[model samples]
Target: MTGHRARRLTAALFATSGYLATIPTANWLTTRYPAAPVAPGVLAPAGVYVVGLTLVMRDVSRELAGRTPVAVAMAGGVALSYWTANETVATASAAAYVLSESLDFAAYEWLRNHGFTIALAISNAVGLIADSILFLSLAFGSLHYLPGQVIGKAWMTGAAVVLLLLRRRAHHSGQLRAPGFSGATPKAVGRPMRRDGGGHDGFGDRAGTPTHPQQNETASEAMP
Candidate 1:
């Protein structure tokens, strides 16, 4: 492979691994430690923090490798949980990941073209809430952790949003060379990239249909 392509793939692999690792790590934390107070009168599993980070990790993987890799990583994460956690925890985590991440994926896609940071935050919000509720209910048969789970995950989500803001500022100020935190604009799932590096729908002029011969060639070159 070309050096550039190889490097991109390597980065994607690392991001995907990070996303998958959080599953077992959260499970381990949950088993090793007891529930703790995350806010006034609100208790949550020790894994709350790690699970919060898990939402961000999935976004990074999706941005780097596209949707397929993220989907695969999610599947792999569920499988890994079975090995790392008890059957109850494994099943709960799997169910939560599938349902919540699906919601996350949709929200992110709908808002991504508007702005990456906004999309990330909003999507994480949806995923975190859904995951927390489902996992807590399924595993513990209660929602005592709901408040703590939301608060803890929000902390991580806020941190991630801030980091993205800094990355964009640095790039714009010429202190960073990458066009995005991922080193490039994220490719839209199942769409050809434009010369301007923006993802678009597969319909209409902005959908990446070449308006000129030069545009046609540029579109081809833009494809990863």
Candidate 2:
């Protein structure tokens, strides 16, 4: 297979693996301990799952050279997370994870396709709004005795915004250009050279006369 195809296959496998791993990790965390701060068992695994999935999606996007599929994959992740959990909190958390992740993917793609500085700013802002609403609502919305959802949402949103900003600043800027050629501009194959020593111009001429001086000189000289 060609190199691009190979890379795309590899990326798809990696993304699938990461996505599968995230489901159990998120479930395990929220279920094992039904309390605040959850536990290291839950939080650590969930955190790792989120980060890993994010990385995988990013890599896949890079490999595919597009953002739409990546966005769709992220949306799938959220749906999967929602389905995996049995409890309300767990379900909420899973749902939150999905929303937050999908938003992140969208933002990331937008920034990638657009200018880094502006894209980063716009995506981060939008991501913060989405993450805050989804995460806080899921994490604290069901808890009766807890403070207002807005309070939690605000804090989470602020933290997420900071993190996104830092991440954007730290990472190298620019979107990944897509691989493979389209029908409109397929990659050129072997080019033909003129017998007359003219440079190749990409067109092959099977019937063109020899243009070389030696061939022509002999023909003309011999002709009297």
Clashing pairs in 1: none
- Report, for every candidate in turn, its global Cα lDDT versus the true structure: 0.71, 0.42
The local lDDT score (0 to 100) that residue 38 gets in candidate 1 is: 71
lDDT score, candidate 2, position 35: 39
After superposing all C-alphas onto the true structure, candidate 2 shows an RMSD in angstroms of 16.3
For residues 79-147, could you state the per-residue lDDT of candidate 1 as single tens digits?
Answer: 888787787877988898888889998998887775566677889887778788899988888997788
Index of the highest-TM-score prediction: 1
**CA RMSD of all predictions:** 7.7, 16.3
Counted clashes in each candidate structure: 0, 2
Residue lDDT tens for model 2, 1-224: 97745755665666555655554455554455333332232222233224333433343343344445555555565556555655664566556556655665577555543333334345444544454355445665633323332233334434544564455333212111224323234232222223332211111123333344344333223221
Clashing residue pairs for model 2: 29-42, 196-211
Q: After best superposition, candidate 2 residue 146: deviation in angstroms?
A: 12
